[model samples]
Target: MRFLRQSMIGVFLAAVSLGLLVYAAYVVQSAVQARLSDDAPAPPPRERVFAVHLERAEARTITPVMETFGEISSRRTLELRAAVAGRVTALHENFEDAGRVTQGEVLVRIDPSEMQAAVDRLSADLADAEAEIRDARRARDLAGAEQTAAEHQVSLREKAYNRQLDLAGRGVGSTAAVETAELQAAAARATVLARRQDVARAEARVDQAATRLLRQRIALTEARRTLADTAIEAPFSGTLSDTSVVEGRLVSANERLADLIDPNDLEVSFQVSTAQYARLLNPEGGLIDTRVLARLDVAGVDAQATGSLSRVSAGAGDGQTGRRVFARLTHASGFRPGDFVTLEIEEQPLPDVISLPASALGSDSTVLVNGEDNRLEVLAVTLLRRQGDQVLVRGEGLEGRDVVTTRTPLLGPGVSIRVLRQEAVVSAGVPDMLELSEERRARLVAFVKGTEHMPAETKERVLAQLAEREVPAQMVARIESRMGG
Candidate 1:
């Protein structure tokens, strides 16, 4: 009976323990499901991050670069116009289409037969006039001789009349003799008057002949000049750009023969805004005579020419407010007028600026800078200028700091970045110990500063930094000076 009671008691205890164990398992399962439901929903899919290369902004002496587009034109241009109406007879060796020519060089000869004939006719007329003048002179000389002879006859007749009078008075002369002497004297006087009239008439004829000869001589000169005009000549040295006439072809008076361009007198014409003009036009601006260099690219020809600044328009063009300027070329060969060309001009430069590839700049005129927390931070940069593929920028904290050079569309503000960068020393005496981790560099820089008053600490930092890589003595001194001892 005692053994039976013990067995029963053991069975009861086993059942109780089995029941408690089942309850505890149910409770534990319920708690686990509740805990999982309450846990913060799995953090949203993490944003994608990109690795990039970084470079430190550099201190540079950047030149002010000006970029413009303009047209090429010749300073010396000429239009070949005919001087008179004539048929084209002969063309000079250099008178072909687009031929080259020099000043005072004949280009073509017109049909000068007509002009030559006119010249000959005028010459003959002048000869006739001169012969008439000579005859009039001879006639006048004969008239004068006759007048002198008539005067001598009159004197002789007077002497005879006086002698006849004395004879009559002495009663030895007859009345008939005295009367005859008087009559003779009177006839002689009348003859002298007639001779004088002839002389006057001859003088008048000579004068008239001289006037006619002078007029004929003038006509001869005009005819010769007209003949000379038959031969065409180049006004200045240049290449014949467009020629419309050919040898053995006839041309009209005042007709355009060709267009000439002086390659040696090439110039580049360009327009600029009013603000830009102010800088270039200031009397003290010093850009008036500044040398302007130009480059020309000829179409369909593998040739180029360089030029210099020659002149600026005195005033803006009518209805065009901008200033126009020109540059003279030294090597104008192989260049034609009215060609378009690109240009680069220099302007005033800003000091202490940084230049980088324009691609790195963002739309808002900002650039990505590596931040303190190893993240990207957008910083606003002031743009000084933009050239072809290059830009000059100025920012508050970009100096001596690493910046992302290339545009990274995937990288945004507050995003973490793993910059894979190489150590490159900046040229302008800026220390490039940036190879060290940001934290490590800051700590080392601080340590170097703290050692200024403590000779032992100074030596320690100097030796440690020197062991890794060389540090500039100037930087060490600067740190020591900044130490708040």
Candidate 2:
């Protein structure tokens, strides 16, 4: 009975398995038919719109400034040298390095005893020559008078000879008497010739004496000049530098004594690319005398001065490209020669030009402008000048148009755009201010005070600014950058 029951259970199990397989086959066939017969449409992709910052393109006269690195220098720097070799006898109270002096102030006095003695001896020689000239003139006069008397006697002798000849011709005079008169006339003629020779010698002596006197006068003038050279006077009011002379120091002719730097006559020299140089020229092709400003950074302190473009270097330096430019400072307080500085040169006013952020310019010399329906349109523009973070450009149909402040690869012509932010055109002026922590302020103050090259007034001003509640952000950045903090 157990074996029969087990057989019945196995047969039931087999039937159930066959029925499950048949159901699975029917479901797979139905799924295949549905997938082959299905018809569905895909949804179209939506166009992408980019949001960017925009600024209005306004046409206005904007002066572009070219900023470059430079060096501060004095245009009226002079090298003080010893004109004559001698021992320095005395020195000015301020004859030292960094000493202030005035024009015509004697700075050095070389030993003048030798020069003075030379002058005295030349003067005496000149006086002796003058006296000799006077004596020669008197002698010439006496010789002339003697020559005249001799000529008179000759005339008398000739008259006597003529009378004797007349007597002889009448046969009333002896031959010996006529011969004697003839001999006397010949001797008187010889005396006249001798007197004429004396007069010539006297004239020659007078000429020699006059020449000697002229030579002596020239020598005296030279000696006086030498004596004057013993006292070295300042040519202009300025400060002394590189002083190498002192009292009792022996110096040679043309030896450098010091450097006279006209602190008031300050200038700055800088360089610019050829393209930039071309734009700084006037319509006549000459460099325009544009306004400039020089700034020197000493630690955290800045020394600023106003100036004008003066001249350009004739040649580009060796192994250098572009032009070297110079500017004359008007009030260059706290500036010293050889100090590295920054120069801001203002170019000519550009009319009908729009100033835009430098990022707005595209590599293809084009800019993106907002068109109708908030779409971007590429506009060709002429890039006039680049002023630090800004660019001056001009283009047709760009005025009064909304321009993209920055360009991106995703933005192009006919592309839809949304302005995330709009900014009005702002002029570049003074730097923004920032509040500093106590530690930062103290650090900057310490740096400014410790700067050896910084002027006292400049340091005080800088300290005053640091002491305030807020400081110039630019100044802080510069100071921190130099401090490597």
Candidate 3:
């Protein structure tokens, strides 16, 4: 009975311990659930916005420039030709290609032996003709004297015949004597007529001799002219090109010998679309004298010259579109024919136009301007002109507004934007001169000098710049790039 009572006491103790453990577990679970039910710390406040570059739109008059490329050519070019066929015997000291020649300078001489011989022969013929003329005059004078003597004899015979007739009538002379006298008179008359015929023949010979002398003189003149043509003279001062003649070479008449080009009188010939061509004309349908800047980039050196629009081609070339125009360069010292150059032509000034970066414009002629609350607003703009990286636009109510200078896919109308920095808008003007170091200047000068094809004036200009303490940095960079340095 005592053991049974002890076992019940142990069971009661175990049950109490188990019940306490269950109550403690429930209390811990309630605390854990309450901790999780509390609201978590809110995320940091975030706003979405696009960062972009911004520029202001200002109303101003802008002169738009149309850029094109063309080849330089001389305003006057002559193809030197051989006027007479002969073997080349002589050439001037400066008669080679690229040789400079002055007007009236003799450049070549053909073999004059043949021409000289012909002239000499003609001269001899002329002298012979003159001698014949003199001889014919003498003959004519002798004929006149003979005719006079024959007429005197005829008169004497006539008087004798008359005497014989009178004697016959008076019965003192015989009829045979009278008849003889009459026949003698008739014979004398015939002799006078023959003398007259001889005089006429002599006069005809004189005339023939005179005509022959004239013909000989004309032939001699022509021969002398041919002789002079053997020497080819420069018609004007210019540089020689495309020379094919050499000493001992036989050339035919009218064959091209060389080309002479007046490099000073250079004009740039370029073609432009019909629309651009129309803009270049005036109200009277004539091309306006628009200012043009021609630039030739050679080995990173810029040979620039100013010019004016001169004229346009009367008709379009075969298989060619657009009108061909020419610009007469002024002070084109370093320019040459066949030089491909860049031409910048100034157009009429556009008034009250806004200039913006080209990237700011959308393909549909719309731009994103920051409107109220710094939000982007799509604005339609008229693209007046595009100059390099910038565009001239005409938009209503666009002045004094900040326009986004760069476009991105993320940017659109009504999208909030944060301008990183406000850019100062300036006009696109001439490129600034660069400053270079002495070493760079020397290098550029050497390179310019080493270029054999560069014109003298261009070399001089480059050298002058190199002589300065500072050279254009852009020019140096260009030269270095080409030098592969």
**Model 3, span 1-485: residue lDDT tens:** 88999999999999999999999999999999999999999999886899898888999998889999999999889999998999999998888889999999999999999999999999999999999999999999999999999999999999999999999999999999999999999999999999999999999999999999999999999999999999999989999998998899999999999999998999999999999998898889998878999998876677889999998999989999999999999898778898999999998888999989899999999999898888999989999888999999999888988899999889999999988756774677654677766676777778888988877777787788778766666767777887788
* Candidate 2: Cα lDDT at 324: 95
Per-prediction TM-score, please?
Answer: 0.57, 0.86, 0.74
Regarding TM-score, does 2 or 3 come out ahead? Answer: 2
lDDT tens readout by residue for model 2, 340-362: 88888888888999988899999
In model 2, how large is the Cα lDDT of residue 59?
96
Candidate order, TM-score descending: 2, 3, 1
> lDDT of each prediction vs. the true structure?
0.77, 0.90, 0.90
Candidate 2 local lDDT, residue 309? 83
At residue 341, candidate 1 shows an lDDT of 73
TM-score between candidate 1 and the true structure: 0.57
Off by over 4 Å in 3: 1-47, 127-217, 419-445
Residue pairs with backbone atoms closer than 3 Å in model 3 (clashes) = 434-473
